[model samples]
Structure formats: structure tokens, C-alpha cells
Target chain A: MRKLVFGVSAFAGLLLACTAHAQEITVGFVTSLSGPASSIGINYEKGMNAAYAYKDEVSGVKIKLIKLDDGSDPSQATKNARKLVEQDKVDVMIGTSSAPGTNAMMTIANELKVPFFAVSPVNVPIPADGHPWGVSMVQTPQLMVKVIADRMQRDGVKSVGFIGFSDSWGDLVYNGAKAAEANGGPKVLTNERYARTDTSVTAQALKVVAAKPEGFLNGGSATQAALPLLELRKLGFKGPFFGTPSLLNRDFVRIGGKAADGTQVSAGPVVVTSQLPNDHFAKKIGTAFHESFKKVNGGEADDGFSGYAFDGWVVFLEAAKVALTKAKPGTQEFRQALMDAIYANKNVAGTHAIYNFTPKSYFGVDERSLVVVKLADGKWVYQP
Target chain B: MNAQIAAILAIDGIASGAIYVLIAIGFVLIFAVTRIIFVPFGDITAFTALTLASLENKQMPGTVGMVAVLAVMATLMEVFSLWRKGALGKIPAALFFYLALPLIPAAIAWATAGTLLPTPLRLLLTVAVILPIAPLLNRIVYQPIADATVLLLLIVSVALHFAMSGLGLLFFGPEGVRTQSLVDFTTFIAGTPVSGQAMLILGSAIFFSFLLYLFFNFTLYGKALHATAINRTGARLMGIRPQQACTIAFLLGSVLAAVSGILIAPVNTIFYDSGFLIGLKSFVGAIIGGMVSFPVTAIGSMFVGILEGFAAFLSSPFKDVIVFSILIPVLLWRSYTLVHAEEEDEE
Candidate 1:
């Protein structure tokens, strides 16, 4: 009887010690840190780190962030997702810089029943039961295109040419522009495609220019998209150039230099936080994120990509706070509770926009979540 | 398409194709002398373009550091070789010409990095900075294994290509950079807008080709190079040093790469890895020339550019396929018509 009592007490004491340290929650981040999409992925990492550092602990639970590089490849992203879920046993997941990689991650998230928040714009068709498995921090292509269409209507653009990467992102942007045309928008004249690693687009540019569009819409992202714009200029083209949310970084401006001076970009509200009204919903947190991000990244302002990542972190934290009350971290119960809290949350203000996720829809924002900004004097000026 | 659009695209083709011609010229010269395919030729062009970009941005070019490291390494190897040959007295002159000459321009360029110098001087300085890389590379990489087989030399060339490309990534990052146009004027040619840069490309290609012809036909040094290319053993028996000929060819190749880079900088965005594709296209052009004739390579590359431009117009995505497919028929024609050399037939 004495030996049995001693063994029981020892077992109970060990369990108490393990529970104390195991109260920490782990979040996995997979993004393109070493390929063509690395610029956006690097900014995503910077923004997420700043947010996590700002909020070190959440509801008395320690948070651990595990970051992995996917090299802008879908296969690598899927592998990262599996490792995070099966081996690290992360309670929640967030990541990816490209749509294809994010789509690949969505499949894994659904299979593993882990809540994944994609920072890039992705349109994954979720079944009724798969709603809680995926949520996107990105504003949809339709939202960005709507903003572009509104601006084009204001600018009285009659015809427009489109050139983009030959991928899903390009298709989505083209479809969104076509949808906008149903509302009496500009006539889409030409659609051209180029690879991300292509060095020249003169042939495509010449064709687009020959079509005689009053304006051009570049459907690609970052510095690579700047190629078509430069080529257009070289071909003696004179027109306004509009870009998608993917061109919301300083690299595009820096690489394009004088040629990018008058280009307009449709982006999230946080891209022009300095110009946002004080009464705006996202103004306060957006400004704070900008200040914190600048302090961390050598005085460079937070871009649309950085804002999306920070917003994802904000949603993750809000859900985590609620889930902590239900179960301890590192348990299946905690994972289930976290996913439920995310879907149940309402009116959560992030740096980019208001998040109101529901069981029926995973994307939280709409057309109101975006704004059109023009590059002026090397800065993003809000076009209200 | 109308004649106007066709004329405009033909000008574009000639301008872009001039870059490939320059690259092919380098490959032909190096292969003729060294039996190496010279795969890193485009990498040198990218490096020069990025170096000019760094200069324009008022930042010291990363190439200065690279040159410094290479200079030190080449000097050490030369000194060691001299010591092994008991000719230590010659080390001072070798170090001065081989090491110090390269560093002088690098030092000057570094000193004048951010200053507003004349455009001519700045472009000249860019040329000077990249000129010594070839001879230095020859001394360090190829000279030690000069007697290696053709396959071994080709393997080394490819390895150098990868190394240089990776080094480009390390130095220039993945961002694509475009330098300011050397001349910023456009004029009409047959109702087609032809930029001054396009004119410069054509002018420079002609000038360089004419200059090479004169050098080979008129200069004793150039005739010596031709002799070396004809038969390395015979040239050595005739007391014309093979190493000296190889060094001159490498220098000429490097200069051509630098000039081509400067010419094309305004036309295309140069990323670190952009060279591989450009180099491969040039290689295909060189192969079409039987890897020997300069005029044949130049014409072949111009055809490539024209085919690419027209295909891109008809169907943009299939342009690469169209351009690469030309090589198959050319190779087949060569196989059917040409007699096999005895050494190659033995293999």
C-alpha cells in the first residue's frame, strides 16, 4: 500500500511539471523566403515578427512561432505544411506568398483539420465542412479589380490592355477585370502573358501597344511586372499604368525607377495609412503597424503585403485568446477550439480591415477593404 | 501586320540580336583558342551591367571587392609558381602588370562611385572595371589545367558558369536592374521609331567586327592568335606562346561582354540569373556557325532574334520553341554535308 501510494504521487508530480511548460501555443508560418516571391515573403516575415513581438503573450499562454521557407514552390509548401501539422503539432497555421502554394497548403489544412490563414490572394473552393479549415487574410482579386474599375471610370479610360504572369493569379485578375466590364467598365483590349523569370517582354509590349489601349493593367507582382511597363515605355507608349495588389512593395518602385513614377496600384487600405482619415476603422492600428514596421525595417513603411500578414496574426491571436479559455495548448481539443473561435469571431479590427469570418465564408473582407493609390515622388499617395 | 509594325519589330530584333552576336563572338574566339565553350560569357555581361547599376545608384560596386579578392589570389599563385621555377626575381613585374593594372581602375571607379562624372567617363570606367576579369580568370582557373582534354575543359567551363551565377546572386541579389540609357533620343527610320540605343547597338557591332578583322589581318599579335588556334603544338614549335595567345583571346572576349552589357542595359532588365538563358541562346547561335565562323554566328543570331520576334507576335508563348527548333535542322544539315574529322571519328 505504501509503495503504491508513493508511485501515484510521483506520477502526479511529473504530470503537473509537464503541463506547466506545455501551456505554450505554437503557430507555423510557411512562406517563399528564397525564390522569385521572396521579396513579398520577406516582408510578410518582418510584419508577422513585429506583431508577435508587440504581443508577446496572449491570455497567459506563451506563443511560439515556427517559420519555414517554401522557396516559392508548391511542393515545398505542401511539405512544410505536413511537417508543421504532423511533426511539430502546431495548433494553428499561417503562410505562403503565391496562390498555387497557398492552394496546396489549403488541401493539407483541410485533411489535417488545422486552421490555415493564407496571406496571399487565393480562391480555394471550400466544401461546406471545410469552412473552418481555411481563412484568407488577403483581399480577393474581385475587390482589387472593382477599385481599379472605379478609378478607370473616373479617369474615363475607354480601353485597357492586360499583361501578367501566365498563372492562376493572372487568370484571377483577368476574370475580375472581365467581371468589372459587365458594369460598363472599360473594354479589355489585349491579354498577354510572361513568365516570372523572363528577361524581355518587347514582343508582347509591341502587340499590346499596337492594340491602341488608352491604359495598361499589369497583372503581375513586384519587380518582374515592371518589365512590361518599361518595355511599353520603350516602344514609345504613352498611357497610365495600373497594377494589382501584388505590386505594393518598394521593390517595384525602386526597380522601375523613373518609369514607375505615374503608375497606380490597387491595394489594401493600410498601404496609404498616412492618408487615411482619423475616423476610418483601420486607421489607428494601421498607423501603429506602419510605425512599428518602419522601426524594425530601417524606416521603410509597411506595404500591403506586410499589412495582410499583420492582420492574419491579429486574427490568429484573437482566436487563440478565446481558445485558451477552453483547453490547454498542444492538444487536439485546443486546436478544435481555436478553429471554432476564429469562425465565431466578429468585428475584429486589424491593420488592413475589419475581420468578420463566418462558417459560410472564409474571406472576411470585400470591395470596401481596398483602395487605389498612385506612386508619386517615390511614395504611395492615396487617390480618394 | 503592316510594313510599319514589321519594320519596327525588325529594328527591335536587330538591336536585341546584336547582344547575342557579341556573346557568340566571345564563344567562338575562346573555343577556337582554348577548346572550352566559355559558358560564363553571359554571366560576365550580367556582372558588368549590375556593376554599372551600382555605380549609377551612387553605391560602390560589389565588383570592387571581387576584383580585390581575385587580385590577391592571382598574385599569390603567380608568386608561388615563380618560386617553384626559381624565377623569384620576375615576381615584381608580374604582380605589377597582372595584379596592379586591374586594381587601378577598380580603385578609381570606387573612388568616383557617387560623384557626378561625365557620361562618357562613367561608361569608360565601367568598361575598365570589367576588362581584367578574363585574363585573371584565365590565370587562376584555366592556366593550371591548360593541357586538359576538351571534355574536361567543357566541364570546367560549366562549373565556372554555375559558380559565377551563384556569385552574381550573392553580389547583386535577385532584383532586376535597368541602367539609364546611354543616349536618350529616338528617331524615325522608314516611319518606324528607332531609339538611339538601337543605333548604338548596330554601330558598335559593326565597329567591333571591323576592328577584329583589321586586327587579325594587319596585326602580328592577331595573326599569332590565329596561328595558335590553327594548331597549338605548331604555334608552340614556332615559338609563339600558347598561354600568351589564350590570355589575349580571353581579354578580347571580356571586353566584348562588357561592351555588349552596356549596349543592352537599356533594352532589358538584368537579373542575376538572366545570363543563363541569354548565354544558352547565344550558344545555340554559335553551334549553328559550326562553332567557328564569326560572320556565320552573327547572321545566325540575327535570324534567331527575327524568328523570336515574329513568333512572339504570332504566338508569344511559343517563341522559345520556335527559336530553339531552328538548331535541329541546322545540325541535321551539317551532319549530312560535312565530313567527320579523323580524331572525332576515332572517338
Candidate 2:
């Protein structure tokens, strides 16, 4: 009888142990794994994988990641978001490489009340009733483009020609420039636009040249961004060329070749992490991310898009840690607690920026997140 | 715009128009003979540009592998069809054309992929690598349904385009590539600085058009293709094989696309999906010609290019809208003038 009583006590103890250590948090990640946006989407996946490898758990709770591809379509992104929330029952959601897809996912996130972290600098509309569930990890186009506009003003440029994609991204950059002009930047001479897949921009380039602006501002991204620069240079427009952070990629330089030299652009500090000062806040975290990324991806991270994704993971982990103290994982209470924790986050150091979130503001970075860089000899050099 | 700006725009328009001309001719050739719209013609051009870029980078092109796989599939399909038809005697000839012909270039490309070759040799290799893709695609995708109506064939062609685009992303990542110019010099033409590359594009367009004209008017095989296009049953009754004519048409079409790709590679960034727009623009040109007259298609393509240039300058964001809108008027005119024939009547 004494032996039977001892066995019962041991079984109860084993059950208690299993209950104490079995918490798992599921994170649903959506990205464009195929289509035109796949180039940037693949980088986001790589960085997210690196971040997962760097920290597989938060506060002693194992993390689970479920990834989906949106094929760069906004409708597909919306469906993925819905599936992640309803079917996968994820605690938090992270996504998306393009603005349109992110915006589409944001609606679903809001409807479902799941906390979402967007890798793209997507604009979230001000809610009339409550705090938004979606937050952006990357700096807004206005904030990044302001740095360039300020530099243009400092350089005494009076007029500038603008060219960009005829999409939301282009509208954002152009509006950013216009806002900067209201605050003592160069006047934009012309607003020319092109599709991402256009084979030639000669007509647009010639028009920009005909305007004879003192400076040129290109708002396009990837290899296509190089088109205007090449055509402008060939047309003898020997003026200062400026760009937004979207032009920050190895493909842009490699395809642009010598024509990309002397081009100035604004970027996040993590883009030039190796050149950052030793005492900088982002340097240590950026170094960690780069190391982990190389280990995961088998090569160095060559673009800034990956750094944004890594920062998203860093921010998510910070919130998850606090949320774990409030409620158990995989519950409605826990998701609400995580959203509250993310909004309450303060001074969360990431590879790209030091994030500070609040109920009123979802884009948590400031001027400290941005830096000016110049393209020279097929590499980006930090510019003070 | 002043005269100098107008001149520059004209030069740019002509160079771009020359590229569309080659692609438009290819569209007309395949549609006339096979009744397939050949929506993936632009994908072939993109593959050629990508192949050339890979060669210049001293990397083994994905085309070699793609072509080899396609060749094997075509050969298997051909052999099976022939066997079912009790034409076992034709197996060797089928093997020679469907399997061996394509593998020869694939083998050469695989052998020299890692070593840098002369620019001319690299161009030749690039062309050779993509030569079998369209023909083999015909065998695999359309040969079995060769008697389908034009609308059905077009639906299949559209589906094939999407598949090719997906495959393109798999083979050549999403990044775009721009190759070095064939002739790296600029000369002033009537006070407008025209690059030698632009001249080469124009020269090649004229030369190929002339050569195609000569082929159609002089060569017996070319005449056979022409006869097949005009009346397939009539040509077959005269001992001409419509299938053989279809294969020959695809061959010639692929050559035009390959040459156009090489010429445009230096001028524009070529991505895995860039071909869709290029092909569509050329399709507009083809539609203007009623997909029948090569010379008229060439003229229509140049007009489209010039209009695109002016439209871009006037309102950049609406350039594509303007270019594509031309199709509506052209379609309306074609419908007003031409008699609609039923599919059964045509067959």
C-alpha cells in the first residue's frame, strides 16, 4: 500500500513538470516568395530565418514560425493573413515586402485583432475608435527622403527633376519631396513616372533633361531605378543625383556599374553597420544580426531590406517576452496582452533602429534611424 | 519640344521600334502557320538576354538545362505518337530532329559555360541555347491539340506564358540584367547623339526583313510554309507537311526573338518577366496588321514606338494607358473592315 501511494505521488509530479515547460508561441509570417517583388521578399525571408536562428525562444517559451507566400499580390496577402489568423491560430503575424500587400494584410489584422508587424514602410490610417493592431518596422518615405531634401538644400540646389514608379511607392516619395519643399527644399521641376517593367525610359529621361534642373531625384527601386540615371548621364545632365532608400541594393550597383557612382541616398544605419561607430546603439545588434545572417544564409546580407526584417523580429521578441508574463500562449488574452506590450515598448534596440512604440504612433523610429550614404566604386560608403 | 529634342525622341523611338518589329514578325509567323498566338514569344527573348548575361558572367546558363529537359520531353512525345500511328520507320528521323539537334548546342554550352569566350561566340551560344525552346514547346504543348480552334489555341498559349514566366523566375532569379554594348561608341546623327548600338538594332531589323523577304520569294521550303499558312489542307494535298512547316516557322521566329534580345540587352534592363509588356506591345503591332502582313506589322510597330515616346513626354504616368488604348481603335477598324469567318469554315 505504501509503494502504491509513492507511485501516485511521482505521477502527479511528472504531470506538473510537463505543464510548466510546454508553452509554445506560434508566429505566422507572410511574404512574397514569387513574382516581381520576390527579390525583396526573399531577402526578408532570409533575415527572418536568421533572426529565428539567433533566438528560437522568448522567456523560456519555444517559438513556432509558419511561413506563407503571397506571390506579390495584395489579394493573396489578404487570404494568407486570414488563413494565418483563423486556421493557424497564430499569436502574432509578420509580413510582406510591398506596400500594397502590407496594406491589404493590415485590414485583415485589424479585423481579426491580431498584432501585426509590417516589414515594409506601409502607411497605417489613423483609427477613429481604437489603437491600430498593425505597426511598421521600417522608416517612412517622408522621414528617409527628408534627409536627402535637406542635403539638397545644403548643396544650394534650386530645382530638381523627379522620376519614380507609377505606383503607391512613387506617390509616397513624390509627396515626401513636396512636403520637404514646403519646408525649404528644392522645388521639384517635373514629376515623371514609369512602370517597373518598362524596357526604356528614354522619353522620360529626355524630358527630365530638358527641364535642366540643378539636381535629379530618382524614386524608383532595384535594377529598374538605374534606368533614369543611365539615360540622364548619357543625355549630359551633369548634376547632383539623389535617391531614396529604396535604391539600396547590390543589384542596383552591379547593374548600374560606373553610372551609379557619386549617387547619394538616404538609408537606415544598419545598411552600413560595419562603418558605424563602436559606441553607436545599433552597431552591436547590427553586428549580431550580420553574423547570424551569414551563418543562416551562407553569405553576407547585401541589402537593407533584410535588416528591416531582422528588426521586426527583434521588436516582436521584446513584446512577446512581456506578454508571456500576463497570459499563456495561444489564447485571445495573450494576443491582446502582446499587442499592449508592443505599444508599450521603449528603447528596443534592433539592427536598423532603436524602436519606441506607443498607442498613438506605430512607426516607432525617428531621425536616429536614418543615415546618408553615397555609392562609389560599386559600394555604398557612409556619408556624414 | 524643339527640333533637337524631337530628333532625340525619334532616334530613341526608332531603336525601340526595331525591337518590337522583330518580335511582331515572330508573332505573325507562328500565328499564321500554327494558329497559336504564341504568347511566350517574349519569354524566349527574355531567356536569350538572360542566357547572354549568364555567359558573360562565366556561369552555366539555365537555358542549357531547360532546353535539354524540353528536348527529352519532345522526343518522348514524338516517339510515342509515331509508334501509335504505326510509323515506326520514322523513329530515327524523329530522334535526329527532336533530340539530337537541340542537345548539340546544350552540350556545347555545358562544355564552355565556365570559360569566357569572345563576344561573337557568346552571342552565338546564347542564340543556339534558346533555338529549341519554341519548337519543343510546340511539340509538347500544342502538337497534340493541333486541330483545335484558334480561340482554344490562344487560351493554351496564354496558359503557357504564365508557366514560362514561373519557370523563368526559377531559372533566372528576379533580378534584372543589362549586358555590354556590341559597339561602344556614339555618333551624331543630324545633331542628335545616336549610339552605335541603336544603329545596329536598326540595321539588323532592315537586314532580317530583307532576308525574310528573299526566303519567302525564293526558297522552296519557305514557299511551302507560305502555302501551309494560306491553306493547310491544300498544302498537305500538294505533298507539304503542315507539321514540318510549323516547326520551320517556330525556328525562324525564335531566331528573330533571339537577335532582338541581344540587341536590346545593352539598352534596357531585362528581367524574368519583362517580356510580357514587350510582347504585348508587339502584339498590338501584330493586331494592327491583322496578324497577316509582315511589312505592315513593321510599320505599325514603329508607329506605336513613336507614339509611346510622345505620350511619355506629354504625360508619363498615362503612357502605357495611351499605348494600349491604341489597340481599341485599331481593333474597331479591323472589325469594321474585315469579314468574320467561322472556325469551321476556315478549317
Candidate 3:
């Protein structure tokens, strides 16, 4: 029932109700906010809210955000996507925070011919079969190899060992880490794998610890991969433990504690926006984010998941505004114009960073999007 | 390898072996009683050690305070049990509640205190918490399941485990935790580094196993409980309260689980999901020990640990594969032997 004009991303057409007069445009914001992953999804919502705050009102006019909660369920995400496209009649839709859930809607968007933008997990498999309507904002697993390897090589790490989970997700990151490490310094000493629910990892960790490697890499979700870190420390492997974005999960810190301290790797840093490279917009944006996030979450901003989702709404609204100009007010022509505007996007500063979407390539990563960040004192601080 | 290297490897193997023995004892206790393999038993180590670590909260400072927490837990169990129907329902309900949010209070407590209490006290405190509740579980869950097939009982035990695990993720969040307490004292004696915590765990396992053996064989109460375990009907015919004996066995089994958790928590960081793994491997240790004898079970668990340790040292990559490969074959061979032994005894 809530109407956010580029405010919250709801399903389908809650926003489509706006252009009835051809006066304003609406976008649906879909993200998980009540499930196990809700807290993380809330971060994405914040980004959308801040972006919607509208300094100059660049996205055609005042935006209304139609918010939909997917609850981190893939089926629910599909239902929400359908709702946005049909009932809410949103001009365009933006944001759902996970890969499986994102992929579910990507298929729906492709079938329905709607644009879908998201943040792909850093170590997830590359969708070689790209969807026409799909554009994830972060670096894909294929490109992450160069970024991680370049950083590890710069840090002079050689002779790495890998502990991977025995699954496709693990394999994707394993291949990425291997490819990344191939061009560089360290020879891989060992690679061990386990089934998803396998709890006994001491033996596997022992293999890496005894190898006397410079550092170790684990490839799995936080729950499965975390056990070995403590076991390795027990067996006297004092070297750094590293992974891709999976390491950035709060569960890792919660699970591993002091064991997680010396660990370092790459992911979207949970940095205050101002601490970024630029002093002007970055500082103001970061400060606003820190204050707003603390108030909303009773703490600081997490990895800006909700914030980025919010930015996705910003993109959808911008395109909707321009779409309204090209198309007859309430027809499907509005959807096409919105899609064209999104595809034509080159540069727009988002809470996560300057957004870039091209007709050719939709993702924003190109060496700068992801950088090395260490888990120090239970919070992220830049390494590179 | 040189003698010094051989010695260090032996010592490392021995220490790890000790941890396996404690798991074995819990396995022996449960298997000896109802022949039902209880998976939630392993979580005793996960949550108990976590509780121990949380006890030195800024608010609480001594054995008295720790005891008070135990009392609170008992009262909560009673209330939750009452909600479930009566005292009998408390078993599953209490465990379910424990699984869902076992670590939140502990996490909050740990975050506030900044450190855990002394190691020995932490271990003892966990035993104290579990000891008072074991009899209650037997009176409710295990005693009723006594007449059922071992397989059916196992299914129920596993169901209880699943419920607990689901709750753990639902409440405590799907995260693991490390025991911040000083678990191991590492020393490089003559150039070979060894984990002192591993030694303590092994020694404790052996010591406890021997004490358990003496109690079961020499004490009247223990014999009555054993009689009840051997045959509930026969124990009742002999004028022993089968109900009280069942309570005793459950208490004894729970105490064993609590002790094992305390010992193993130092070996691996305790997490909610750890219970099943702990229970399975420990039960395996008991099975390898013949499922009837405490001494052998303790010895069996240690041996399993050493073999696992040796496998890790040898094949670093597929270490688990190697260990389990040996274990499965040995277990199959042993079952065949046990079957043959039974036939020969019949003859």
C-alpha cells in the first residue's frame, strides 16, 4: 500500500499508477527484509532511499518508491517480480540482493522483457549466457580473478593452499582463485573439499596448516568454510586466511572472532562514503549514510546492500522519467523508453559508487569496483 | 624420521586421540542404555562450552553466580516443559528452545564480559548445567522410546537433532563461534611444538572412563542402573525401581555428554551444528569400542583420533577420505566378526 516514487522498489506496477496523468514516473523496489537475510537486504534499501533523496531531481521528476519484500525466498522473489510487472504496473523494477533470487527474476524479466539490475556475489559463476534484461552492478567472478590476483601478488603472497566446498558455488570461486593465482607468485600447495553439511574440517585444515603455506583460501558460504579457520589456528598456521566476498559476511566474524582478525581479502568495503577517494560528494554521501544507517539499524551501515538496491530504484526512476517522454503515457512504450535509458547509462554516482551501465556491458566492475579490504577489529578497513 | 620427530608425531597423535576418547564415552553411555544414537548429545559440547565462555560475564563472577545461571536454566526448562503439557514434554521443548537461541545470551554475555572464566571451572560448570537435566530427559523421552526398535528410536533422536539444528539457525543465526578461553598451552619441547589442551582432553577422557568403569562395576546404584539397561523388566522383577534406574542412566549419559563437550570445545570451536558431528563421531568411537565397554570405547575413540591425525599428516588434501575409508572398512569387518562371534557363542 506504500507509494515511494523511486522511493521503495515494489513489485510490477505500484509505480505505474503514477504516469496515469503522464505527470510522474514510478519504480518498484524489491528486496528481502524479513527473512534470515533481511538485515542484509535492509542495507540495500538504505542505498535506494538515499539516492531517492534527490539533490537535483535528475530522474525526470519527484520519484515514488513501491517497495516489495521477497523475504530472501526465490519463489517469493518470482511472485514479487510478477507483482511489480503486473499489478503494481511499475514502469521498471530494481533490486533483489541474492544470486539465486536475482537469477529467478532475471529469467522472469527476460521473458517479460523488463530490465533487472543487481549485485552478483564476487565469487559466483559467470552467467556466460547473459540475459538481455540482466545487469548486476558488481564485478562478476570471471573478472574478480585479475583484481584478487593483482592484489595478492602486490602483497607478495606466494604458495597458496585452497579449502573448497564440494559444490558448484565452491568450484566457481576455486576456478577463479586458481586462475587469479596462476599468473602470480604462490604455488597452490593443497586443495581440499567437503560436502555442504560436513562439520569435520579439522583434518582438511590440518593439511593446509602443516604445508607451511604463506596463506590459505577457502571457497564456500560462511557456515561451512568457517570451521577450518579455527582448526588451522589450533594446528599453528598463523598465516592469513583469505576468500572472496564470502569472507566479508558478518557470520564469518561472528563465527570466527579473534580467529577472523588477521584474515584479509577483497569485497565491497563497508566504508563511510566520504572516506572514498573524493572529498566533496563522497564525504557528504558517506556522512548522510552513516547517520541514517545508524538511526535505522541502531549501528553503522553494513556492506550497503539496501543502499545499492535503493540506487537501483534511482536508475529505474531516471529511465522511467525519460521513458515517459518517448512513449504514450500509460502504454508499454514507457517500459521500452525506461529500458533504453538504463541501457544508455554511462555514469551516475550512486551510494555504492559511481554507477555505470552500458548497452554492451551492464556490470560496473573494472579494477576499481572491488579492492582489498581486511577484517580488522571486527570491521572493514582498506588494505590496498 | 629422527626419534625426536617420531616422538612429536606420537605426542600429537596421542593428544588428538584423547579428544576422540571423550566423544567415545558419550557414545558408550547412550548405546549402552537404549541403543539409541542421540545426535543432540553432541551439541552439549557446542552450547555448553559456549555457556562456560559466557559465564564470566561482567555481571557474574564466581561459582555461585554460575550455579545461579544453571538454576535459571533448570527453572526455564521446567516452565517450558509445563507449557508443552507436563514434565515429559520438557525434553523436546527444552532442546528445541535451546537450539533456536542457544548462543544469543552467551554471545551477549561474551560481548559484555570481554573474557571467559578459568578453563577448568568453565568445563565443570557445563557438567553442572547438564547433570541436573539428564534425569528429566530420560523420564520424558528416552524411557517411553525404550520399547521401540532401536532404528525407530534413532529416527526420533535424529528428528530431535534436526529440530534443534533448525532452531539454532533460526534463533542464534547461522554462524560458528570460537572458545576465547585458553584452550591450549602450546609449547615447543626440544623443538617439537605440542598442544597442551589436546593432552588435557585425552588425559581427562582416560581418567573419566576409568572412574566410570569402577562406578558401574563396584557400586550398587550403578549396578542397578546397568541391570535396568540390560533388561528393564528383569530389573523391575528384582525389586529395583526401573523408572529411577532409567533416570540414573539418563543423568549419567548427560553428564558424559557435558564432559565431552567441555573437552572437545577446546579442540574445535563450539557451534550449534556441531552436536550431530560430535554425536556421530563419538558414537562411532563407542561402536568401534564394541558399544558395551567403557574402557574399550575410550581406547577406541583415541585410536580413531590418532588414525585421523595420521591421515591428515599423510594425505593433506583428501585427509577425511583416507580416515573414513579406513574406518568404514574396519567397521564392516568388525560387524562381520561380531556376527560370527554371536553364532559361535550360540553353538
The numbered model that scores best in DockQ is: 2
- Against the native complex, each candidate's DockQ, computed on alpha carbons, is 0.41, 0.71, 0.26
Q: Which digits, one per residue and each the tens of the lDDT, describe model 1 over residues A275-338?
A: 9889888898887788778767765655677777889888888999899999989988988898
TM-score leader: 2
Ranking by DockQ: 2, 1, 3
TM-score of each: 0.87, 0.93, 0.79
A1-384 per-residue lDDT for model 2 (tens digits): 999999999999998766754488999999999887887899999999999998999988899899999999999999999999999899999999988999888888888889999998666675666778878998878898898898899889998999999998789889999999999899998899998778788889899999999999998987799999998999988998899888987788888887789999998888889998889888899999999999999998878888888898999999999999999988899999999998888999998788988768668888888888999898888887
Please give the TM-score of chain B in predicted model 2. Answer: 0.97
Model 2: per-residue Cα lDDT over B71-157, one tens digit each: 999999999999999999999999999999999988999999789999988999899989999999999999889999899999999
Error of 3 at A250 (Å): 5.4
Q: Over the stretch A1-384, how does candidate 3's per-residue lDDT look in tens digits?
A: 356644566543565655533554556777887666665777677666655553324344554568888988989989999988888666566767767788787777777876677654422333445536656766676555556666667778886777777677667767777777666646677777765444356656666765778988777666446667766776668888777766666767776777778676666533535445654333454566566666655656666465555456555655655665677533577666766777776665455555667645657645555657777888777674
DockQ score, prediction 1: 0.41
Q: Give iRMSD, candidate 3.
A: 4.3
**Candidate 3 lDDT by residue in tens digits, B179-282:** 55454367777887667776676677778777878988899988887886676667779999865665566667776767766665545545556666656656
